[model samples]
Target chain A: MCVLAEEGYTGTADVKAFLAEHHGLALSDVDGHLYHHLNEEAIRHLFRVSSSLDSMVLGEPQILGQVKDAYGYASEFKSIGAVLDKFFSKAFSVAKRVRTETKVASSAVSISYAGVELARKIFGDLKDKTVMLIGAGEMCELAARHLLNAGVKGIMVTNRTYERAVKLAEEFDGTAIRFEEMVSHLKTADIVISSTGSPHFILKRDDVEEVIRIRRNRPMFFVDMAVPRDIDPDINDIDNVYVYDIDDLNNVIETNLEERQKEAGRAEEIVVTEVAAFRRWLDAQQVTPTIVSLRRKFDEIREAEVAKAMSMLGTDDPKTRKVVEALASSILNKVLHAPVTALKNDGNGRDPMELVAVVRELFDLTDGGKDCE
Target chain B: MQTLLLKSTTATYLVGALLYLYFIVTLKERGARLGRMFLLIGVVMHLFGFGMRFAEAGHTPITNLFESLSFFALVIVGAFLATELRYNLRVLGAFVAPLAFLFSLLSAFQKSELQSLNPALNSSWLPVHVIVLFIAYAFFAVQFAAGIMYLMQERQLKGKHLGAIFKRLPSLDVLDDINYRCLTIGFPLLTIGIITGSVWAQDAWGTYWSWDPKETASLATWLVYAALLHGRLTVGWRGRKAAIVAIVGFLLVVFTFLGINLLPAGKHTYASIAR
Candidate 1:
C-alpha cells in the first residue's frame, strides 16, 4: 500500500481526492473510523501534542505531541492492529525523544516582547515609565515583568477578577487597580499591555483618544496581544497612539533564522529515521497470517494421510502405527519448508494472503480441518 | 582569539540572506534547505565572534550601547532558533535572517573603542538588567513574526490568495495563539528587567521614575501591549485590528530603541555608545 502524508494537502476536496486516489479510502470512511477509534486517552494525547498541557505555553509543542498522541492512541485501541500499532508507536517514541533531547521549548519568543521592544525603541530608557497592564492573566504578568525589567517606573494591573489582579500585582510589586478604573489608568500610562479574554474592545477609540489628549503629544504604545484583541483597531489611526496586534511582531521574529538553522538539520534527521523504522514494521506485518495458514495446512495433510495409513495397518502392531504417524508429520514439514522460507523472504513484494490460498489448495484442506500442522 | 571566524560568520550571514531571498522568490523546498544551511554556518561564526569580543572585553559584552545592541541581536537569534525548533517554522527564516545580518552589520560598523563604565552603569545589576531586557526584546521579535503572519494569513483567507506558501503558513488561529503565548512569556521578563533597572538607577543615580525619553518610550510600549492583552481577554478584540495594533506597537519599540537614542535632549543619550 502507498503511504502518503496529508500535510501538503490543502483544500478539503483535495484532501478527500488524494486519500481516495492514493489509499483507496474515502474521507468519509476514514472520518468515522478516526473519531470512533479516538478515546479519552487519545484526547489526552492530542492535548499533550497541542501543548495544552505545557506550563509556559499551550500548543507550542503541539505538532509532535499530536503525532505521538495519535500513534499511541491508535496502538492502545487496537485500531491499527499489531502491524500498524508497532509502526505508529515507534513514530511517537521518536517524536518524544526529539522533544526531550532538543532545546526546542527554551525561549518564550512572542509578540508581547515585540510591543515592549517597540516601546523601548520609541523611549530610550524604560526607567520611570508608567505601565498599565490591562489584563491580569499570565500574558499580562509576562508583559508586566518585561516592562518592569526595562526600568519602567510603576505597573498597574487591572483585571475582571479583583483577587487575580491583586495577586498579579503583588507578585510584580505593582499596584492592583479595579477594572472600573481602567480608563483612569489608561489616561496616565505611557505603555499598556492588554490580554484580556473579552469578546469586545475594552479600550474604545474615543476612550483612547481622550487618554491621548490627557497625556499630551507623548506617545503611548499599545500592545494588543489578545486574540480578539483588547483595544479598538481604530485606535491605531489615532496620532501618537501606536497600537500593535500580533502580526506586527512577525517582522521582529523573522530575523532569527540564522540561529534556528543550526537545529533544523538535527530535527529533520530524527524525522527521517523514525519514518524508515515505521515503514519496516509495517512491511513485516504482511507475512504473519501467511505463516499461520501455512502451518495449519501442513497439519491437515498429516492428519488425512495418517488416517489412511492406519486403516492399511489396522491388523498389524500398534508400534507400526506410531512409526507411520511420525513419518507422515516429517513428510508434511519437508513439503512446507521451501514455501515458508519464501513467504518470510518476500521483502516488499510478495502478498501473504496469496501464499495462504496457495498452501490451502495444495493440501486440499477441507472445511472444519482441525489443528493442521 | 577568533577574529577570522567572526568575519567569516558575518560573511556567511550575508550569503544566507541572499539564498533565503532566492528561496522566497523561487518557492523551492531545496532553496529553503540551502538557506538554512547558510544560516547555520553564520550562527557558528557569529558565536565565534562573540567569544573573541568577550575575551577582549574581559566581562560580559553588554557594557556599552554597541555591545548591548550586538548582544541584543544575538539574543533575538537565539530566541528565534528555539521557536523554530518547537514550531518547525522554517518559512520565517526568510525574514529573520536579513534582520540578524543587518544588526550584525551595524555592530561591525560600531566603534570598538573600549571605555570605562560610567559611575551609574558600573553596578553589578547593570549586566543582569541588560541581559534580561535584551532577552525580553528577543521574545517580542518572535511575537512580531507571528503577528505579521497572522495578518498575511488573514489577508490570504480574505483575498483568496491561498497559494502554496499561504497553505504552508500556520493557521490564523495558531499564529494568534502563538503571539499571545509569546507575549505572556516575554512580558514578565520585561517587567523584571524594568524593575531591576529601576533599582539600579535608584542606587546609582539617586532616583527612579525620572521620565527620561527612554523611560517614556518603554512605558508607552508596555502600555500598548498591556492594553492589547487586556482588550483581548476581557473584550474579545481580535483579527485584523488586533494584528494592526501589534505591528504598531513593535514600531514604537524600534523608535524607542533607535529614535530616542538619537534625540539630543534626553538624559538617556545615545552619545556614550555612538562614539
Candidate 2:
C-alpha cells in the first residue's frame, strides 16, 4: 500500500494517472485510493514500516527481514535508481538501529516461539534433533511447525488412534509410533512435545530417567502443551531433562510480551530521530545537483576570463600562464564558496528548494535548457 | 635471542588471550581474527625460540622444567590453532588463549638457563618420548577447557537460566563432540606415548617397566583416558558425565606432567631434584 517515488511534486500527477490506467480505474477513484505523501513523509512512512512500528504486532522482527529481501530483489533487478537505493539502505540501517538500541525483537512474544526459544537455549542448534508429539492437538501441531521451521531434523507423531497419528506424521514427513510404543521410541527424540487428550501424565520421572541413562545423559527438552499436563513435573528434576508445561510456557511468553511492550516505546523514539535525520539527508540530496551545476558555471566563467586576460597580456611563458590559471581558479572558488555554503546549510532550518531555486535564478543555471529535474 | 623471542611470545600470548576474552564477551569477529593473528605470531616465535634453545643447549631442550613447560605451552597453542582451524570454533579461543597465557607465564618464572642433560635422558629417545607425551597433554588441555564449557552450559540449561552467559556458551552437543574428538586423538597418542616411554625406559634403565611416581602416574592417566574412550565408544557415555570425566582425566594428566616432579620420587624429576 506504500509507494516510495523519487523526484519533486511534478511527477505525482503522472504516477496517479499511470496507476489509474494500469488498473483500469477512474481517475477520481484512483486519486481517492492513492493517498500521496511528499519526500519527507514517504521516507518517514517507509522507516516506520521497515522498523515494524506500523505493524499490528508492534515489534515483530520478520517485517524488517522481509523489507530487506524486497530491497535486495529491487537491487538485483536494477529497478531502483540512486535515490531509492540511498533511501532503502538508510531505512534498513534505521530498522537495525531500532532493533539493537531497543529490546523490541529480543523477547519471545508468541507461545510457540517461546517453546522454540527455550529449545534453543537447551539444545543450541536444533538441526539434528528430533521432536516427538504425543497427540494431534492443534496447539501441539503449531508448536511442532515452529520447531520444524527452526530446523529440527525430524518429527514423530503418536496418538491413541493409529490412523490419526499416521496422518499427522505424514504432514510432517515424520514417523508414526503407536501410542503404546511412544515411550519406547522416546530415546531417539531430543525434544518431546506432548499434547494429548489424556487426563493424566503419560510420562513420569522414572521413565525419563531410564531413557536418559540409555541415551547416556544427552539433554532432552519436553514441552507439555496439554491441559492435563502430559509430562510429569518431577521429570524436570532429572539431570539433563527439562519439562515445561503449558502454564510455564505461557508465563515465559507473558513476561516477554510485557518486556517488548516497554521496549516498543523506546523503539518509537529511535524511529523519530532517524526519520528526521533521513529527511535532512534527503534535503541535502536536493541541493547536490544544484551545487554541481553551480560549480560548473563558475568554472566556465573562470576559464573564459582567464583566457581573455592571458591573451591581452600576451604571456607566451608557460610559467606565467600556469600562475594566472591557478589564480583564476582560486578566485572563482572564493567567489562560489558563500552561495554553496548557503545552499548546503538549507537542510538545517530553511526549505532547501527555496535556496536551490534562488541560486539557479541568480546564476541563470536553467539557461542551459534542462527542462526538468 | 631465544630467551628474548620466548619473552615476546609470552607478551603476545597475553595480548591474544585478552583479545579472545573480549571477543567472547562482545561476540565480535574482528577480535577473534586479531587474537588468532597474535596466536599465530606467538607460535612462530616460540618455534624459533625452540630451535635456538635446542642449538644452544645441544639437546632437544626439554630436559628441564623451564624447557618442558615452555614446550608444553607451545604445543597447546599449536593444537588449539589446528582445532580452531578445523572446527571454526572462534568462541573457544576465550577458554584456550588464557590457559596458554597462564602456561607461558608460569614458564617465564622458571629458570630459563640451559641445564646439563640427565645421563638417563641423554639419548635420542628424550625428544620422541617427551614430545609425544607433551602433545597428548596438549590435546587433553583443550578437552579440559571444552569440558568446563560444557558443564557451564549444561548447568545453565538444567537450571533454565538462559542468561547472557548461557547464550554465549556453545551447545552441549558441540562441546561434547569436541570432548570426544580430543579424547579419541589424545588417548591413542597417550597409548603411543606410554609405549615409547617404556621403550626408552628399557634402553636407559634395562627394564621395560618402572614403578617410579611419574611412570606410575602416567600409566594411571593413560588408563583413565582408556576407560573414558571405552565408555564413549561402547555405551554412548557423553554430555555431563563425559565432560566431568574429561575434566578429571586432565587433572590426572596435570599431576603426571608436573605434580609428580614435586614429590621428589623418580628419575623423571630432572628439573626439581637433579637441577
lDDT of 2 by residue, A102-156 (tens): 7777767777888898888677789999999899787889999999999999999
Candidate 1 C-alpha lDDT tens digits along A1-373: 1121221123445545666667778677755533211222332333233332322442145565556666666657654433334334554565566555443442234655645655654454678688888775666667777777778998888889989889888888889999998898787788888888999999898898787766644557787778887888778776555677766555444432322344445654655555554444333234555567567767877888888888876656778878998898788788777877877765325344344445545655333322111
Model 2 local distance difference test score? 0.83
Q: Where does the lowest 10-residue lDDT sum fall in candidate 2 chain A?
A: A364-373
Candidate 2: where are CA atoms >4 Å away? A1-45, A53-59, A65-86, A96-109, A117-128, A216-218, A247-277, A285-373, B273-275
Among these predicted structures, which one has the highest TM-score?
Answer: 2
* Local accuracy of candidate 2 as per-residue lDDT tens digits, B1-275: 89888867889999999999999987777899999999999999999999998899889988777777788889999989988987788888999889989888888888887778778788988888888888899999999999999888877666654556665787677788899999988988898889988998899889999799988998889888988999888887888788899999999998887788889568777866233
TM-score of 1: 0.43
Give each model's whole-structure lDDT.
Answer: 0.64, 0.83
TM-score of the second chain of model 1 compared to its true counterpart: 0.88
| Cα misplacement distance, residue A223 of candidate 2 (Å) | 1.7
**Candidate that scores best on lDDT:** 2
Off by over 4 Å in 1: A1-373, B1-8, B24-27, B270-275
